[model samples]
Target: MPDLEPHRRELHVHCYRMLASYEEAEDAVQETFLKAWRGWDKFDGDNLFRAWLYRIATNVCLDMIRRTSRQVVTMNSFAEVPWLQPFPDRMLPSDEEPDAVVVNRETIELAFIATMQLLPARQRAAFIARDVLDWSAKETASLLDISVAAANSALQRARATMQEKLPERRSEWTSAELSDEERDLLARFIDAHERCDAAAAIAAAAQDIRVTMPPAPMCFNGLDQLAPLLERAFGPDRDGDWKLVPTVANRMPCSASYLRRPGDTVFRVFKMDVLRVADGKIAEITTFGPSATLKAFDLPQTL
Candidate 1:
């Protein structure tokens, strides 16, 4: 009702940070928009439109967290069926101003999101609103419907918990600050995957890189380990003729890799592999998702 398009996209991003699942974020944003429309007549344009949207989105996410528990996929926590889903890279709306103008991988990585899941709902909101979004304590307090002092307390607790859970690579976490060379490195990584060249792919990765596949509990660390892993995945014996569709997730450059099967004479979409780079080399890789959301990334299901 009030110039919704600009605020809508940002609100979607905000909801995503609150609720790591992309589908849930979409639902929350829809609910926020509907509520905004219904309450439009009573609105006073005193505060920023984005701020008002954040308030709605925050409340929506809070309701969701109150109802559902955080998703965990560790070895001790494996279940009869996988419970979490990866966000499709293609569905994330592009920015006219480039990645610099939007959120970064440091704040939105799957690792960070999983770490956030450990915090209480209000503490999670307070930390993200204050630290990640750069909102002031007073502003975050107003949005969360709590006192500024309480917000500050929640944020501090959240930060302390996250510091222990996440890796200590704060310098490389800022995705907005990636250099031209770093971007080019990602481009080359994509090119290598599309060409199905394992050597080139290995060359692009760090010597001791860590590749983690969520919801699967498979992890390969170090170049020696990763080389064999890549060979098994992309080699001629298994899932040959690989094609990587360019996309993004967690505010980081990503690709949904598809495999061309000779027996079926068609390409089958498979994994969503999201990358994290540091110092112009692939540092971490997290892969997941099924065919349902894979199509949303504009990837070829059967090429």
Candidate 2:
């Protein structure tokens, strides 16, 4: 039998894009590998091994999606899909990998992942395969076991939906790396958290900034709604002293926060905030708990 380990990372990323959860993607990759090993005799020597693995991985994701009741009824905010999670940059394929799927800023960002949840399972797979992965219509159809015409139709619908739901300026965002403006804004954000300065944080955010904490039904829009939360976070009787470390997730600027409650000597991992910046200010902040994600970022549990 041939080695299957080489394809693991890219397969995991493909599953992540389809399912929008890190843990679920990991499971899907494992299931794919198991199925591939069991059915290796079915594989033709003439066909590409990587594509075969992807076919298995994609189907695994589709099965997982069907079994779960994680459908999104409306395409509004990231909070609406509580299952949404950030993909750590450390696990992404390095720029040097030849066959690695290009993890561009537009495709892997939080907004794109959350919006993709609005698509049906098959359409999401089609979009990722045909458009994101640059697969041919015939190739995608073969992967999904559908006719070429049907695959094209699915890609069309998926593209239309993505364009409608994604931000208008998405087309204009060309840089794959973080810009200086974004780094500056992130610095201000981290400094504000460490200093407990709400004003500085607010200044770094857009006037209509939005905040959402997933797995919790909390969504706050605009600075007016955001102020009270910041006030409480930095208040005299707040949880404790805060420490923030800058990191990158989903090709966007992020901060991993640590908190030391009253009498707690060491700061402990709290949550991660993935920022979506617009016009030099933070336009959206999607926050996730640190327990399931910190290790992916290679962050310490306590400081």
Instruction: Pick the TM-score winner.
Output: 2
TM-score of each: 0.79, 0.97
Local error of candidate 2 at residue 63 (angstroms): 0.3
Model 1 accuracy (lDDT, Cα): 0.71
Clashing residue pairs in candidate 1 are none
- lDDT (Cα, tens digit) per residue for candidate 1, span 164-246: 77777765766544457656776887788777678888888888788776556666778888878767766777666766666
Alpha-carbon deviation at 14 in model 1, angstroms: 0.6
Per-residue lDDT of 16-45 in model 2, one digit per residue for the tens? 888899888988999999999999999988
- For candidate 1, the per-residue lDDT at 281 reads 84
* Model 2, CA-based lDDT: 0.89
Off by over 4 Å in 1: 41-47, 71-101, 172-200, 223-228, 290-296
